[model samples]
Target: MTRRVLRTLLPAAALVWTAAVGPAAAAVPLPIDAPLCGPAELERLDGLQADLDAKAAAGEAGRAQYWYVDPRACRLSVAVLRGAEDAHTEGFVGAALAASALPAPTSLTEVDEPVDRRIARVPAPAQRGARAAGTLHGGSAIYSGTSGLVYECTSGLNNYRPGTTTTAGHCADAATTWYDARGNRIGAVTDWRYPGTDWAVITPVAGWSLPNDVLGSTVPVARFGKASLGEAVCGRGATSGTRCGSVTAVNVTVNYPDGLVKGLVRSSQSGGEGDSGGPVYDGGTGLGLISGGASSGSPTFFQPLTF
Candidate 1:
């Protein structure tokens, strides 16, 4: 009986669930008539999707759930299947263009498109890491979203429990590791908020300590004020470091590979991977958290810091 119980439990424990949030909005299907290449490009797009479906089904990739075709920008974004390895799907992007009259895509950008529905399943006390511009606060690389790098600040509660705890929405791409200044893994991400709002509260699991200081760190926080269109803002992230720009637009629909993000503020500040969940601030006031940027470098979108 003991051997049988062990055998059953081992297989059940071995299962790996590639978790993700659902689409922020309903699935907006890609129309066949969306217009890519003239008549010659259909096969290429179809073949690419076919290959993607195959790969996704086999767990080699996640579904390319969202895509956008903007003739004005001449840009096409396709969401890849799950797992970071699915990034390889972009490598085949050339094939998609082969069937199109459009010129071969000069570049392919990958962004997370987390949906609102999946937020509840996210772990708590999700772990993450950051590399500061330099040493500060008696040392660089503070753990929370508020040290090292300078960023826009906002005001809000951590998990929206009335007046429980106010927290920042910085630190995107929630991980499961307690990382050090030099990028060493110390813990794992226990919980995280992906799609709903950028705000997520992280608890210390596996014996990690939350930084006690708030000065001169990259940990994001809320300041004050409601941002408007064309408002100038500053942002700091683990990637692209610190940069200042203006809010280009608001209530924009951004399609991330993870899912759709609606009612987002679009900004001109440039951000890249590891920059997700960075603070979007109106001067010293916090505006939102970096969700994703436009496929082109035209603008960035962030989840407004609303508690």
Candidate 2:
């Protein structure tokens, strides 16, 4: 089932959380320029962008690499394999978009990047002295003994429900029950999804509560939203603390070591092991969940909340 469908089946209260203008520690404003498209035009551009993403997900070769609505350029940001850029490809895209009955995006921005790539799950860091905390926050040390994992990972955005929290769904595979740094019982997995998407929700075990905040940062997750192109977003993993970087692309398909995952957000931020399922947010709005990286210090990738 789709994430949206699963969400709708959940109790309305299960999805409750508050996020507003929370924190801007890493947020960067877009450059000054007239918008590429007006309201009506933006609608068409967005619709076309969605169509392009759908095609890419369906394995349509030469479908403009991958795409997302670049609000800053007021265009559809696209990229192609080093050798696949050609008029025929662009023309093919244009022909497909014509059926939308809307003008094309203000422009199609081609980024200089490779089409094929590899990434691995942000591996958990070496064991650290477990220091227990009275309350857990994003970036707090957490571990699960469910899957023979000897490493621990960081916690993620919390308060999905009054008594629940979240993390990478892969973490759930390693943990049926979660524990805090101090070895406190945090909770157990309520639901999780991976591969196509990477995320999980955990209900706090007894004697604990999941709040909507991150450790070492004033920003509290008061809302959930997208991290726009060129926007700076911060992610907190147990080992990396709070790492921040600009988003390079969204709606990206990544070939992870274990499987191919689609619709991930890619950024320049670095994430360490033990940070799986950590939260990536733009100011007060939650953006995505850390999925993996190319290396220990390579560009970081995440699962957009909506994806």
TM-score per candidate, in order? Answer: 0.41, 0.61
Model 1, residue 254: what's the lDDT? 40
- lDDT (tens digit, per residue) of candidate 1 on 62-170: 3333333333223343433234454445444433434233332211333443322111111122334533322221111223222333222222222223222222233
Tell me the spans in candidate 1 whose CA falls farther than 4 Å from its real position: 1-174, 182-191, 204-222, 295-297
lDDT of 2: 0.61
Candidate 2 at residue 192, lDDT? 86
Q: How many residue-pair clashes does candidate 2 contain?
A: 12
Model 1 scores what on Cα lDDT?
0.40
Worst 10 residues of 1 by lDDT: 1-10
Predicted candidate 2, C-alpha RMSD? 12.8
